[model samples]
Target chain A: MNNKITQNLYLLPYALWIVLFVIAPLLLVLYYSFFDIEGHFSLMNYMNFFTPVYMKMAFSSFWYAFLITFISLIFAYPTAYLLTKTRHKQLWLLLIIVPSWINLLLKAYAFLGIFGTKGIANSFLEAIGVGSKQILFTDFSFIFVSVYIFIPFMILPIFNSLNEMNPSLLDAANDLGASKWTTFRRVIFPLTINGVKSGCQVVFIPALSLFMLTRLIAGNRVITLGTAIEQHFLVTRDWGMGSTIAVFLIIIMFLIMSVTGNRKRGV
Target chain B: MSKLVRFFFAIILVSAVLFYTVHELNNSEGYSGRNTLTIYNWGDYIDPQLIKRFEKETGVKVIYETFDSNEAMLTKIEQGGTTYDIAIPSEYMIDKMRKERLLIPLDHSKLPNLHYIDKRFMDLPFDEDNKYSVPYFWGTVGIVYNSKMLGGKKITSWNDLWDSDLRNKILLIDGAREVMGMGLNSLGYSLNDTNHNHLHQAKRKLDLLTPNIKAIVGDESRLLLENEEASIGLVWSGVASEIMSENKNLEYAVPKEGSNLWFDNMVIPKTAKNIKAAHKFINFMLDPKIAAKNAEYVNYSTPNKHALSYMPKGTVNDERFYPSPELTRKLEVYENLGKKNLAYYNELFLEFKMHRK
Candidate 1:
């Protein structure tokens, strides 16, 4: 009882801060979502969220985020496997982490310098007597930058899972006359599924909301739910609409988290 | 622990808290009193020397913060946390703020130097009789092109953006209102039209032009000019001026159809704690010499008639800076659309973005 009391006392400040900052603000957003700017309670803002344009923007955001997650996993898995196989793991880890320490905005800007119309890629192509200019501000740049920015998130978790794998299981599969590829597929891949799932979750959530990169690098040619929320709050000054969209986003995130959590519990 | 040491620790803790609280209180009070004023404005939109002169003349310290967009400034004020004594918002946004009752009416008598302003800029639709806003700078949205890259072909209309010859070699402003308004204006409709069918037609035109566009850039027309990324672009006059200054090959021209004329104005918000200081600062900036110095420093056109005389002889005569009366007559100022129309316009903007291949 005394220990519990001490623990509660220790958590008091954190609980108060969270309630004041996070929970209170979210509750205010929820309240605003139900009303218009007139202060009277109304459902116009929520009704507006169901418009076809908002639906399209939300779907596009999800689709792009899904694609970025899947692509990052595909590229990350092999790299993580290689890192585990390397003898000098610390040096390889350093190489990966060092670039991540560079600011995300700087990295996005770096890609701009390399992929712009007169950038290195185009100059190289020009030197080879090929095409003189290149396409840089299309959907392709959006996906490329998102995948590059989020590869580290995918790799770290998969790397941890791979590193934790017991060699004995693979040796056992080999002893049982299974082929190397089959053993790896059956034993190794199944064990790392949790890590892959977690990594994908991390990558998806951020990519869904990380529209600033899209705006700056993709030149605001693409619109996402994140951009819509920003425009509603900042540009339109419609906090009611902005809050409604934010609430909808939170609901979608909650659904994703609960479904994933239930699957993990069942496993 | 010894009683003496415990007492010392308590004193230290109490003093630290007191110091922090005092610092915050001081910051709040300093801006509220006659000692200082706070101004929020658009980035690179004003002359820093003007701020310095205001500070020196009035003995009121100025704390200035810059935002890149009018929407951003409005959102900050709407949150009702920070106390900004003065702000500069575009004409349309000023209308929106006035409807929201977010602005405090100007005391023109307090601003005696208002005589320096051209009468045409005053009593405009956004704030008639200049009740709330003071016009700071005015310019137009138009097409800027490289003569060398265009193969000596004279570009005249918005249709030039859709030309097949410039495929994958054109640029447009990233702003939805600006780009969509251009399409609407080219279609012989008002730039601020919120009609659904008109918007759809504008979207169709933009969709057709998207393939030819290399970038939809904001505040980076110089990058496009230096890199030769696009042969032509829909850009602001301020950006066009900067590009022309750097590269002599560039030329700015208003479209034959028509274009947007915008004016950013200074206003005091109702939430301001230092109204007197804000008014004094506005009057100080209105001084013709100060206005001229500001206009020369920041490359934007000033509304002060007296300031125009003080500008460099070439700048005063420059056609781009001061368009001919005929050209000026063709321009239209953007007006605030009603709520329903704003929704429709935003919806159409979304459709254009999503339906693009």
Candidate 2:
């Protein structure tokens, strides 16, 4: 009882911070979503969210985020699979995660240097006489940088689930004369659905709201939903509209979580 | 099974806490007690020595803070946490604050050095008769080009940006108003053109330049030029000044066709606790030596005619910093286009960004 009480006391500041920072701000956004600029209750903000331009923006943001999530999964899966099979697996996992410790903005700026016209990539291209390429501010650079940034999120959970798989069960499937591909598909893959769900849940939501990448590396060319919210809040000074967009973003994120938050727990 | 579910929750909760805490820490507010002159200005906008001198000379505490954008400054003032005595806002924002009564009328007697303000920089639309704001820095939107790539052709007009030879070599300013204003000026319309049809025409003109364009960017425009990623960029005079200082081959010009002339001005907010100290601070800034020091430190043009001679050795007669009257005749100032039109302009810019083929 005494130990439990001390632990609760230790978490008190964090709990208070969450209430003050997280819960209060979320409630404020929800409140703002239903109002206009004049402090009157209205659905105009929500109504405006469905306008043609906004609808198009929402679709594009989702498409780009989906692309990012899908691409990160493709790259991260094999790496995570390899990690589970490695001798020094812990060290390899540490290496994979260590780069993520660097600041996102710093990494993006460094990439800008690497991707600029006089950058190493372009310099190499010119050295080979393929000619310099306009790679910076292109969609390829934006997605490539995003995939680099978000890959760890896709890898960790999948690693956990793969590492947790019952070796005896795999051996049993092999002993039952199931072919390698078939056993892996019908047995290992289905069992690891929980990990995949958990990983997707981690990666998908933030991919929707990633702003700095869209701005810095993409040259403000890609208008993600997060960028739109920033414009409304800071540039346009429309708190109501920004909040409405944020609310919709939360709804989309929640939907993503639900779809990926596996209900069948006994995987 | 439950452990995985709990693990996912813990991951999200930790990230949420991290993001919220970092954001909060970055924007943590500061307060001033009494007899303090609190001034809010742009980041790295004014020299530290000036703030120290002001404090030392006046026997008053100085609580200085900085914001990066005009909109951010406006948001903080509207939210009303810190009691900022004096704020340096851009002309359009100065106008908005005056209209919104966020600023108080200045007492000219307290500001005796107001006479040192160049007649050319005064009596502007943003603060008519110098009621609310005193010009801090004035500059124009212009082209900064790498002469090495121009091949003996003197690029002197906005049309130069549309040249097919400069394909994917032109970098435009990132802001909605700046980009749309460039489009409007290129079409022989006013930079502050409000007509719906004129805006559409500007958009069409921009679409043609899109093929020749490198990217729409801000802050990094100078780096882009230095890196040779872009041969020419439509950027602010202040940034252009910084660029020329870095790379000798780069040159800046206020296109003959004209461009937006912008000014940052200082004003006393209505929430001022020490209005007298605020006036003293503004007057101190107008002191020729102090104004020169500020201009030298910030690398932006000063509007103090008296301070021109005192400008740091190389900056005074720099044509990029001081345009002739003939050039001034071709320039226009950006006016607050109202909430609806500003939104419309932003939408247009975003649409253009989205449809990048």
Candidate 3:
């Protein structure tokens, strides 16, 4: 009981901070979602959320996030596997992690240098007589930047999971006459599923709310729920509507996580 | 553990917490001294040298803050959190702030350099008699195009954005007000129109144009022009000038339908602590030499007649910088739409954004 009291005291600061900053703000968002500027309680904000335009935007945001998660999973799994098997594992990990230190906006800006009309890609294509002009500021650029920014998130988790896997289990499977493919399917895949899910959670949530990169790379051609929320709060000065959209986003995220969690638990 | 090691660890942790506490306390106090003045303005909107000059002249330390949009600035100010002495807001926003009792009216006697302003821009709708705000810079919203890509066609009006040939080849401002205002102006409606039918019609036209938009952009016209990511875009004159400076192929022109003529003004908010220092700083910036130098650096048109006289003859004569009086007559100033109208406009903008097509 004394040790338990000491541990609670140690946890107090962090618990308070979480409650104050995260939970309090989330509750405020929920409350504001139901109230208008005049402090009248109404469902107008939520009903407005159901509009076809916002519905489309919400769908697109989820769809793009899912696509990015799937792509990152495909790319990161092999990369993590290769790094684990490599001799210079630390050096390879350092290389992958290095770009993560750079500001996300700077990374998006750098994409402009490589993909802009006068950028290297276009110049090279023009020189080789392959293509005519730039590829920057399109939907492709948006996806490309999103994938690049999020790949690190995907890789680190999977890498840690792979590193934690017991080599003895693989050896035992081999001894049982399990082929390489069969062993990977039965042992490796099942074991790494949690890491993959957590990685998706990390990448999907952030990618869904990515406003700056979308604004920069997509040239605002693609509008997401995140951008709409920003516009409402910052530009329109309609906090009621902005908070409503944010609440909707949180609910959708909750639903997605719960469903995914249940599926992972096989319940 | 050794007593010495435990003592060292406790010292390190205590000192770290102490340092963080001091930092937070300092930040919370903000500009406290009588010698300090905080100015909040748009990003990259002013010449840094002008602020330095003001500080040097008045012996007041100037802390500069920036926001990308008027609404963002208003939101920050409305929270009653940040104590800013001077803020630069657009004309309509100035009116809004005045209505909200957020602004402190200026004493013209304190601002001796107010005489430098041209007679034409005075007594404007937003702040008639120049009570609450002083005009800093003025410009028109217009289209910037690459002449090389338009097939030698002069992209004269907002209608050019909808030309079938330009499909998937144009860009527009990401700002709802600017774009929707342009659409309204193109349809012979007021830029500040709040009529639901007018807004819907403008939105429908924008719907047709959305698919053609290569990207919507704000404030990155320099990159867009240099990279050729867009052939034409709706941009402010200051940005247009920057684009033209970087790329010779780039050109800016006001649409034949007339475009938004906006003026960013300097004002003192009610929460200002150092009103005297703020007034002195404003007068310092209004000095003709200082104003002209700022205009030259920022590439925006100054509202000061004396500043114009001090500028190079060619710059003053440049049509892009100083449009013909006839062209000036065609430009319409945006007015602050009342609350109900603002809500209606916001709804339309939100609906359009939600609708993918």
lDDT tens digits, residue span B227-340, model 2: 677889988888888778888888888887779888999999987999999999999999998999888888889999999888665677777678877768778988988887
Model 1: clashing residue pairs?
Answer: none
lDDT of 1 by residue, B1-357 (tens): 699999999999999999988678656644334577889987786778777767667767788898878778887898899989999999998999999999999998899999999887889989988899999998999988998988877778888777788877777775778888988988999898877788889989888887777766666646766567677888888878877787887888888899999999999997798899999988988999889988887787888999999989888788887786678888888888865566566656656666654
Per-candidate DockQ values are: 0.46, 0.47, 0.51
Candidate 3 chain A, poorest ten consecutive residues by summed lDDT: A258-267
- Per candidate, the number of residue pairs that clash is 0, 0, 2
Chain A accuracy of model 1 expressed as TM-score: 0.92
Error of 3 at B244 (Å): 2.0
List per-prediction Cα lDDT, in the order shown.
0.82, 0.86, 0.83
* TM-score of chain B in each prediction: 0.88, 0.86, 0.89
For residues A146-253, could you state the per-residue lDDT of candidate 3 as single tens digits? Answer: 988899899998999998999999999999999999999999989988788888888998888778877788776677889888977887666788899898888878
Candidate 3: list runs displaced more than 4 Å: A1-8, A37-39, A126-129, A262-267, B1-34, B324-326, B350-357
For model 2, what is the error of residue B195's alpha carbon versus the real structure, in angstroms, after optimal superposition? 1.1
Best by TM-score: 3
1 or 2, greater by lDDT: 2
On residues B1-357, what C-alpha lDDT tens digit does candidate 3 reach at each position? Answer: 699999999999999999988667545654234578889989988899887777666667788899988889988999987979999999999999999999999989999999998887787888989999888999999988998877677788888778888876776776778878987988888888888898999988877776667776767766776557778878898888877888888888898888898899999998788899989988988999989999998888999899988898987887876886677888888888865577677666656654443
The list of candidate 2 runs beyond 4 A from truth reads A1-31, A34-48, A127-129, A265-267, B1-38, B52-64, B107-112, B271-277, B312-314
Misplaced by over 4 Å in model 1 are A1-4, A7-27, A36-52, A128-130, A167-178, A262-267, B1-34, B49-59, B109-112
